[model samples]
Target: MTTAFSLAPLFRSSVGFDRFNDLFESAARNDSASGYPPYNVEKLAEDKYRIVIAVAGFQEQELDLQVEKGVLTVAGGKRDNGAQNQEKDNVTYLHQGIAERAFKLSFRLADHIEVRNAGLANGLLTIDLLRQIPEEAKAKRIPINGQQVLEREGS
Candidate 1:
C-alpha cells in the first residue's frame, strides 16, 4: 500500500523550498523497471557521504556520472563496439543469469552538495560527495550595537 503525505506543514515555515518539495514528489512517483545494480549510501562524516554501486560487468569507460541542477546521475552500460558485437553474435547462453543491461540512477542533492570523486574497482563504483558550505553562506552571529537602558515614566 502506498501512502500519500501532505507537505503543507513543511512549507509553512520554509522559504524557497518548492524545489525540495518537487524532489520529494518526483522520488515517490518514480518506479524503475529494474533495480539492476544494487547500491549503498553511507555517511562517512557529518558532511561527507559515499555511494557504492555494484557494477559487476561494467567497465570504467562504460560508466558515466554527472551532476545537473542539484541532481546527481550515475549511469552504466556496455558500449557497442564492432569487436564486442561480433563476439556477442557467436555466443549463445543456455541460461542467461548475468545482466548486461544499461541502468541510470539519480539522486536529488540538497544545496551545496558536491561530488568530490568517483572510482571504479573490483566491480564496484564508488562516488564520494561533500557538502561544502561557502564562507558567506555559513552562519554568523551579528553583534548588537549600543545597549541603552530605558526607564518608564510610571516606573
Candidate 2:
C-alpha cells in the first residue's frame, strides 16, 4: 500500500497548531511496515522516550535510521533465505516453532522532539527520544492578574 495510516486530520483542523499539524502529516509517510519484526515504545521521563525493537538477525549495515520532518523511521532487511536452501538445510519439520524475518518500523514524534541516540546490544535495538517543552507549555505563576491582582508592592 502506498499509505497505511495518518495523523494529519487531528492537527490540521485546529488553529495555532501549524507546527504540530505538519509533524503529524509527515508521520503518515515515514515508514510503512509489513510486520516482520516487532517493537515497543516506552516513556523514560517526562519528556524522554525510547523505542526498543527486536532485530535479532539484522546487522548494522542492513539497518537504517532516519528522521523525516518529525517522524522517526527504522528499517532493516536480512540476507535472503531462498526456498531452494530451506529444504536442504532442514531435515524435517514437525511444527515450525520459530520465525526469523526482516522488518521496518516508524515512529511519529511531537514538535521539537529529537533523537538522542540509538544503539544495538543484546539483540535489541534501542532508540532514545527527547522532547523539549515549549515555553508556552510550561507552568508559571498567573501574576495575580485582574481583580485578583495584589496591591502595590510599595504599599
Candidate 3:
C-alpha cells in the first residue's frame, strides 16, 4: 500500500521556491529508483562535502562523472571487451549475487556548489564538493545614512 501527499500547502505562502518544491517532488517520485548502487553523503566542513558510492566490479574506465546545470551525474557500466567476454562465456555461476549492471545517479547541487575532485579506490568512488559564496552575495552591514542626517538637521 502507498499513500500520496501534496506539497502545495507547503509552498502556498512562499515565493521563489518552486524549484525547491520540485526537488522534493522529484525525490519522492524517484524513491523506487534509488536501489542498486548504494551511496553516502557527508559534510566534512562548513563548505566542504563528500559523496561516496560503492561501485564494485566496475573499472575506472567504465565509470563516468560529470557536473552540468547544477546537477552531478555518475554513471557506470561494464565495457565490451572481446577477451573479457570470451572469459565470461566459459564461466558459470550458481548464485551470481554481485551486481555488475549499468547504473546512473544524479544529484541536484545548490547554488555556488562545485565538484572539486573525484577518485576511485577499493571499489569506492569518492567525490569532493566545495561551496563558494560570492562576496557580493554574502551578508554585509549597511551604514545608516538617513538617521545621522536627520539628527544633524534637528540639532
Candidate 4:
C-alpha cells in the first residue's frame, strides 16, 4: 500500500514552486516500476555533476538522449534484429542475469544547469552536467553615492 502526500499546505506557503509539485506527483505515480539498470550520481566539483547508468546490453546505436523544458531523458533499447531474434530462439538460459529491456529515465534540471556531454564506455553511460550562472543572475555589489549638505539656508 502506498500513502498519498498532499502538497496543498506547502503550495500555500511557498512561491515559484509550481514545477516542483509536478515533479513530486510524477515520481509518486511512477514508483511502481522496477529499478532496473541501476545508476549512480556523483558530484565531481562544486558546480559539476555526473550521472552514470549501467547499460550492459545496450549499444551506442540503441541509446538516445534528449533535453527539453529543463528535463533530461535517457532511453536505451532497440527492436530485435535478425541476429538477436535467432539467438533468443536457439539459446536456452538456465539463469538470466543481465537485463536487456527497454528503459527510459528522466531527470529534472534546475535553472542554469545544463548537460555538458555524454559518453558510453564499459557498459556505463555517463552524463556530465554543468551549472553556469549568468553575469546578471550573479550577485553584485552596489555603490552608494555620497553627497555633502550645506547649512547656509539655516543661517
Highest-TM-score candidate? 3
Span of ten consecutive residues with least summed lDDT in model 4? 8-17
The global C-alpha lDDT for each of the candidates, from Candidate 1 onward, is: 0.76, 0.66, 0.78, 0.75
Writing each residue's lDDT as its tens digit, candidate 1 over 1-155 gives: 99998764333221122476664566566546425677777778888888888998888899999989877888888888999889989999999877878898777677888899999999899999888899999999977768756677897
* Model 4: lDDT of residue 75: 87
For 24-60, candidate 3 gives per-residue lDDT tens digits of 6665565554676988777788888888889999999
Candidate 1's C-alpha runs over 4 A off are: 1-23, 142-155
Tell me which residue pairs clash in candidate 1. Answer: none
- Estimate the TM-score of every prediction: 0.73, 0.58, 0.78, 0.74
Better of 1 and 4 by lDDT: 1
Better of 3 and 4 by lDDT: 3
lDDT of 1 at 112: 84
Task: Please state the error at residue 104 of candidate 2 in Å.
Answer: 1.9
Q: On a 0 to 1 TM-score scale, where does candidate 3 land against the true structure?
A: 0.78
Candidate 1 TM-score, true structure as reference: 0.73
| lDDT per residue as tens, model 2, 92-154 | 778764454556566656667789899998778898888777899878885654584557789
Q: For residues 61-90, could you state the per-residue lDDT of candidate 4 as single tens digits?
A: 999999898878888886678987888889
Best-first order by TM-score: 3, 4, 1, 2
